[model samples]
Structures are given as C-alpha cells and as structure tokens.
Target: MNENKEYFVNEEDFIVSKTDVKGRITYCNQPFLKIVGATQEQLLHKPHNIIRHPDMPR
Candidate 1:
C-alpha cells in the first residue's frame, strides 16, 4: 500500500452535507439547513426530484 497517499473519510464520519452521486440529498447532518440556507418548511416538499429538468440524463 502507498504509505504516502492520503485517504478520504467516509461521509457519515464527516460533518459535511453532500448530495448523493446522483445529485440528491440522501442524508443530511444537523447543519443541513444552515449549509443550504433553507428551512424545514422549504425543504419538506422539495426533493431534487421536483425541480429536475426532463432533459437531465438521469
């Protein structure tokens, strides 16, 4: 193994909110709202599936 190489921490172990590989919010940390600047009410009904354009390859 390459001792000089670095490794990335797993998402669950880090504090970061990420979009899934398919670009959707699957799991969010406590700071999700502060990061996205949205309220629970704003995020409730708005999963990425809503605003997705038909042209998207997915």
Candidate 2:
C-alpha cells in the first residue's frame, strides 16, 4: 500500500541538490538524502522528480 507521510526539516537544516541540464540528479547533500530516504547510488543519474512530492506543482 502507498503511504503518505510528512517530514519536517529543522530551521537550521539546509537541503541541497544539483541536477544536470536534462534534470537528472547529479549531486545531493546528506540532509536531502536523509529526507528522501535514498542513497547517493540510488539517486545519482536518476530524474530529480523521483523525489518530488505528489502535492507539489509541476
């Protein structure tokens, strides 16, 4: 089953990621990886949208 949950980041926490011109993930910081529950190996070269929230506007 698909589960919906909310994750809150700390006020001082900063999430950072970078994508290629084609929108493929190139780099992501540790905080971003933790929030997305993915590893560098899993996210690298993948589409940035792979971690987009459903409620987010396209």
Candidate 3:
C-alpha cells in the first residue's frame, strides 16, 4: 500500500532544480536529491513530475 507522507524543509534548506523545455529534469542540487530520496543518476533526464505528490494539482 502507498502511504502519503509529508516532508518538512528547514529555512536554510534550499532545493534547486532545472528542467528542460519538455519538463524533463536536467539539473538538480544536492538538497533536491536528498529531499526526493533519489540519486543524481536516477533523476537526471527524467520527468520532473515523477517526484510530485499525488495531491498536487496539475
């Protein structure tokens, strides 16, 4: 079963990412990878939405 979990970020924590014109991830910072629980190899070139929460509006 899938569970919905919320993650909190600190004020000093800054997540940065860059996506291509097609919304594919091209660049992401260390904080982004850590928060998303993904490695650079896994996230690069993948759709940015892959990490989006289901509750988020389109």
Candidate 4:
C-alpha cells in the first residue's frame, strides 16, 4: 500500500457502484468516479477492491 489520501462523499450524496455476483465491478456512477479518482474505463470489469484503502480494516 502506498501513501493514500482519503476522499469524502457528501452526506446527502449517493455514490453508486455495481458489482457482479462474483464481486467484480460492472458499473459505477460519476459520484463513485470522483471519490475513487478513477476513470470509467479503469473501473470497468475491475475488482471492487481496487479502490479499497490500505488503512481500512479488513
């Protein structure tokens, strides 16, 4: 894990992302992109864990 900074989503905002039953990302909304700092192309078909922070508890 590298040095990562946290990005916050608004309390009233909804961050939408969809994953397959196997836990691979299938779709993600713009708000999800902003928070993850990733482009749609980067996220498509990726594992949902791609955006997980190293500091996060397992």
Among these predicted structures, which one has the highest TM-score? 3
Superior by lDDT: candidate 2 or candidate 4? 2
Error of 3 at 53 (Å): 0.2
- Model 4 Cα shift for residue 49 (angstroms): 0.4
Model 4 agreement with the true structure over 1-58: per-residue lDDT tens digits: 8998999867438889999998889998888899889999999998898899999975
What does the lDDT read for residue 8 in candidate 2?
95
TM-score of each: 0.33, 0.72, 0.75, 0.72
What overall lDDT goes with each candidate model? 0.56, 0.91, 0.91, 0.88
Residue 57, candidate 3: Cα error in Å is: 1.2
Q: Write the per-residue lDDT of candidate 3 for residues 1-58, one digit (tens) a residue.
A: 9999999987447889999999999999888888999999999999999999999987
Please provide, for model 1 over 1-58, each residue's C-alpha lDDT reduced to its tens digit, 9 standing for 90 to 100.
Answer: 6578778876545445445666665555655566566655555534555434689875
- Lowest lDDT sum, 10 consecutive residues, model 4, at 7-16
lDDT per residue for candidate 2 within 1-58, as digits (tens), equals: 9999999977438898999999999998898888999999999999999898999987
Candidate 1's C-alpha runs over 4 A off are 1-29, 49-58
Can you rank all candidates by lDDT, best first?
3, 2, 4, 1
